[model samples]
Target: MAVHKVSLDEFEEIEYSIIAIHTPLEDYRLAYTLNLILELNLSRSAKDILIDIKEGKSFFSKYTFYDCKKDITWHLIQNKNEVTQRNNKKKATLFFDQNLEIPAQTYLLPELKKADFFLKIEACHNNFNVTKTVAKMNTIATINMVYSVKTETIKSKNNLIF
Candidate 1:
């Protein structure tokens, strides 16, 4: 599977899509990842895409929805990028809280601004690299920063989940 940008040609092929919204406020940052994933899961093809990417494939931005599957079993883990505001601008980061049930390739990437991205790899349940823990927040197990697209066009190849 791969992440590609959706073009005008494949509008009909898109089964489902998630658009992320990030707001940098004074006290804490807000991300609409949960809303997006929830919407995506509601689509007809979301399940298929999620299952495929669990193998850890590679996807690009800007593509079509004809590239997905229909056997997604796992849910999009909690948003990892949700962070509190800090005085240092450089310290701010959007992290995806990866879980043991989810695969590696089927994980979340950075905020998408334009274009699309895809992954095709199965991450291990015990992956313990680049983890982050917040006070009352779920611990982030892995970090897979993908691409960002400007247009609403999103193309997913596969996904990671139970």
Candidate 2:
């Protein structure tokens, strides 16, 4: 009789790049701007990234573009989703009782809460110039700032698998 065991190293890991974007423009507008500037055809995905939270499920907008020529896939996703939660406890006033709705924000990466959005670049067996891409994104007037984020420091890395 023989026994065999598999090691984690046997599995191939997906290598990707992360770029944090701080912008005031909405997701659609930002996607359009990126399309025009970066020559990418980013379109909204049919299904959004949903995360289960204590309050409720938070849906984050996702835009995707795949460059077949370069073998690179680009994903622009909203890092924050504001969910409105209704308070079950009713407030009694002089006139009547009222249910208050409070707005709660959920972040994909809690450590990077300040980042409005995150651009994920996944290149398979191809060289991608992240610095040049970041430079180009910085040219956009609507974007306040653009910078690279080290994936090693991300505690909630699983949240980005989608």
Which candidate should be chosen as best, given TM-score against the real structure?
A: 2
- In lDDT terms, which candidate is top? 2
Number of clashing residue pairs in every model? 48, 0
lDDT of 1 by residue, 1-162 (tens): 999898898664322223232222211111123223222231123222222232444332221222135332222222222222223223334774332333232224433332122212222333412122111112112222332223244233232222
TM-score of each: 0.18, 0.92
Error of 1 at 34 (Å): 10
Q: Please write out the lDDT profile of model 2 over residues 1-162, one tens digit for every residue.
A: 899999999999888999999998999999999999999999999999989999888999999999999888999999989999889999999999999999999999999999999999998875678999999999999899999999899999989988
Candidate models: Cα lDDT each: 0.27, 0.94
lDDT of 1: 0.27
Among all windows of 10 consecutive residues in model 2, the one with the lowest summed lDDT is 121-130
Report the Cα lDDT for residue 31, model 1: 19
The Cα error of candidate 1 at residue 72, in Å, is 16
